[model samples]
Target chain A: MLKELDPLLHSQLRLGVMSLLMSLESADFTFLKEKTNSTAGNLSVQIDKLSEAGYIEVIKSFRDKKPLTTCKITKKGIKAFEQYVEVLKQYIK
Target chain B: MNDEKNLTPQESLEVITSMIRQAKGNMKKSSFYFLLWGWTIVLANLCVFILIKFTTITNPFLVFGLTIPAAIISVVYGIRQGKQITAPTMLDNINRWQWTGFGFTCFIFAFFGQRIGWQINPVIITMCAAPTFLTGIMLRFKPLILGGIVFWVMGILSFLAPVSWQFLLASFAVTFGYLVPGYMLKKTEA
Candidate 1:
C-alpha cells in the first residue's frame, strides 16, 4: 500500500513543498516557490496534482486585484507523508 | 479566521508573510542569547577579581547575585545590538559545541575541585552550570532560561551550609554553571 505513495512523494519540488508545509500550518505560494526552487508554472501544476489527490487545500484570494495562492496540508497529506516514510524505510533496510 | 472569506488570495498571502516575518524576528533574537551570556560570564569573573583586590571582602557571591540581574537587563537591552540571523549556519552547531564544552569543563572542574583544597565553589560551578548549558543545547529553547534562575537560587542557598569559602562557591555557581548554559541556548536554536 505504501508503495503507491513512494513515487508520488519522491518528486523533488513537491517533496520540498510538503516538508516545508509540514512545519507550518500553511504557507504562501512565494514561500513554497522560494523554498522549493520551482518556477511559478511548475509549482502550479504540482499543486494542482496534490490538490486533486486531496493531499492539500489551496486557497485563492485577491489583494489589490492580484491573485494569490496559499497551500495547506490536509489530513490525507499527513497520512501520505507518514506512509511514505514507512515505505521508504524498507528501501534503506 | 473567516475574514479570509471575502478577501482575495493576494491579501491572504500578504497576511501570512507578515506573520512569518514577525515570528522570524522573535526566533532570531532568542539565538543571540548565548553571546550575551558568554560576555556576562567573562565580565563577572573580571569584576570579582577587581572586587577582591580592593575590599576586605572574602566572599564574592553577593556581588555575583548583583551581577546576574545586570546580565538579565543587559541581555534584554543587548537585543538592540545583537545580530539577527534569518538563515541556518554552522554557527548553530557551534552553539551546541560550546555548551558541551562548558558541561565537560564543569565536570572536570568538579572532579578535581572536590579532591584537594577544593572549596565548595567548584562543586557548585559544576552542579549549577553544567546541566544548565547541556539542557539549553538539548532543548534548543530560549524560555528554558528558567533553568538558570533555579540554578542561581540554589547557589545562593548553598552558601548558608556552614561551608568555608561559600562566597567563592556562590559566585562561581552562577558564572560557570547557569551562565554557560544560558549562553549556549541561543546557539543551539538554529
Candidate 2:
C-alpha cells in the first residue's frame, strides 16, 4: 500500500530546513537562512510553523549582546523525518 | 527556497543528501591543537635534553613550565572558537571529551612522577598514543592513525633504551605522531 506523504514536510523551504537540522546538533537562524537561501520573512514563518507543530525546538537567546536564535530537531521530528524517508523510498521503488 | 512549492521524492532525497554533506563541517580547524601541542611537546623535550646534557641547571624540568602558557592559550582559543561555532557535531563532543580524559590522566601521572622515576617518559608516551590514535580514527585521517602507532612504538622503544635517551625518543614520538600528521591535516584542509 502507498503511504501518504507528510504535507508539513512536502514544502521546499521547510523540508530544506528540516534536512539541515537533521544532521546538526543545533543550528543558528542565520545558518538556516544562509543554507536554505530563503528570505528572512519566509524562513521565520516556516520555522514558526515547525515550532508550532513541535517538530523543531526554537531557542532564542543573546549572543555577544545581539539576539541569537537556534533551532534543533525534536524527537517527534526525527520520527517523522524517518517515516518520511521510508515513504520516499517506497515512492522511489 | 519557495515555501509553497512541493518537492518530488527524488528532489527531497537530493535535498537530504546535500544538506547532510553541508553539515559534515570542516574539522580542519582541529589541526590547530595538534600542531600547537605537537610543537610545544617537541620543544619541551628538546629543552630537557639539552639542559640535562649540557647546562649546569639543577632542575631541568623547569622547561615544563612552558605548558602553563600553552594551556592558557588553548583555553582562550577554545572559548573564542566555541562562541563562533554555530553547529557542533557529535564527533566534536566525542573528541573534546577524549582529550579532556587524556588531560586528567596526564595530571595523575605528573602527581605520581616521583614514584614512577625515569620510566615516566615511556609511560607518558604510551599515554599519548591512545588519544592521538583514537582521534585520528575519528577524524578518518590515515596520517594521524599512523602517527598514533608511531607513538606507541616509540613508547616501547623508550622503555628499552637507556633512561638518558628517553627524552630524545619522546621528542621523536611527538615529531612523527603529532607534528607530521598535524601538518598533513592542515595541508589537506588548505
Candidate 3:
C-alpha cells in the first residue's frame, strides 16, 4: 500500500518552491517569484505556509538597505519531498 | 502557480523535476573572473620576464603589484554580482570557498617568500591547477579540465627550468589554464 502524500507539499506553488530550494543552498524571494511564475502575493502566502509547517526556513535580512527574504528547505522538508517522490513513483508504476 | 489547485502525482513530479533543472544555474558570469585574473597574471609574468632579461630593475617582482588592483576589482565586482544573485547554488558556494582557500595559501606563501628563497613560482603554478581542475569538474566543462592539466605540466616544467625561465613558463600556464578556458566558457554561454 502506498502512503499518503504530504498535504503541505501538494499545492503547485508550494511544491515548486520546495523543489527549487532542494537544488539550491538558498534562494531569495524574487527568485522564487520569477521561477515559479507566481505573483508576489501568492508566493508570499505559500512561503509562509511552508515556513509555518517547518518545511522551510525563512531568513529575512537587509541587502543594500533594502529588505531581503531568503528561503531554504529544512531537513524535514527533504524527507517529505523524497517520500512524496517515492509514492509518486509507485502510483506511476 | 495556483495555491488552491492540487496537483496529481505526475504533475507534482513534473514540477519537481522542472524546478530542480531551473535551479541548476549557468556559470557564464563566472567566466569574467577567470578572464580577469588570467590577463592580469599574464601581464605581470611578461613584465617581470622583460625587466629581469634586459632592464636594470632592482625588484622585478614589484611588477606583481599589479595584482593589488586586480584583487580590488575582483572583490568589488564579486560583491556587486553577489548582490544581484537571487538563487545561490551549492556549486557557487563551493567555488567561492575553493578560490578563497587559494588566495589564503598564496598570501601565506608571499609572507614567507624571503624565508623560502622566493622559489614559490613553480608551486604557485601547481596551486593554480587544483581550483581550475575542480571547477571544470563541477561545471562538466572539458576545456577547463584540459587547461588544468596544462597548468600542471607547465608547473612541473617551471620547477626544472632556470629562475628567469620560470616567469615565461608561468605566462604560458596562465594562457592555457585560465585565458583559453575562460574565453571558451564565455563563448559556450553565448
The best candidate in terms of TM-score: 3
Q: Estimate each model's TM-score.
A: 0.40, 0.91, 0.93
Residue B185, candidate 2: Cα error in Å is 2.7
Per-residue CA lDDT of model 2 for A1-93, tens digit only, reads 999989898888888899888887788999889888899999999999999999999999999999999999999999989999999999999
What's the TM-score of chain B for every model shown? Answer: 0.35, 0.89, 0.93
Best by the lDDT measure: 3
Q: What lDDT is obtained when candidate 1 is compared to the true structure?
A: 0.55
Model 2 per-residue lDDT tens digits across residues B1-190: 8887668889988888887887776442478888988999899989999988898899888787777788788778888887788887777767887887887787687778888874688998998998889888878989889999999999999989887688899999999999999999999778
Model 1 / residue A81 / CA error / Å: 1.3
Between candidates 1 and 2, name the one with more favorable lDDT: 2
**If you assessed candidate 3 against the hidden native complex, which CAPRI class would it receive?**
high
Which structure is stronger by DockQ: 1 or 2? 2
Docking quality tier of candidate 2? medium
Clashes of 3: 0
Give each candidate's interface RMSD in Å. 14.5, 1.1, 0.9
> What are the per-residue Cα lDDT tens digits for candidate 3 across B1-190?
7888878888988999899888875432479889999999999999999999999999999888788888889889888888887887888888988887898898789778888898988999999998999999989999999999998999999999999999999999999999999999999778
Superposition error at B142 for model 2 (Å): 2.9
Write model 1 residue lDDT over B1-190, tens digit each, in one string: 1211343324333433443443232322243444455455546555665676567777653544544565467545544433222232233335445654654665465457546554545354435544454445445554345555545665656645445445444545555444555555545655
Fnat per candidate, as a fraction, reads 0.00, 0.75, 0.95
Output the lDDT of residue B142, model 2: 91
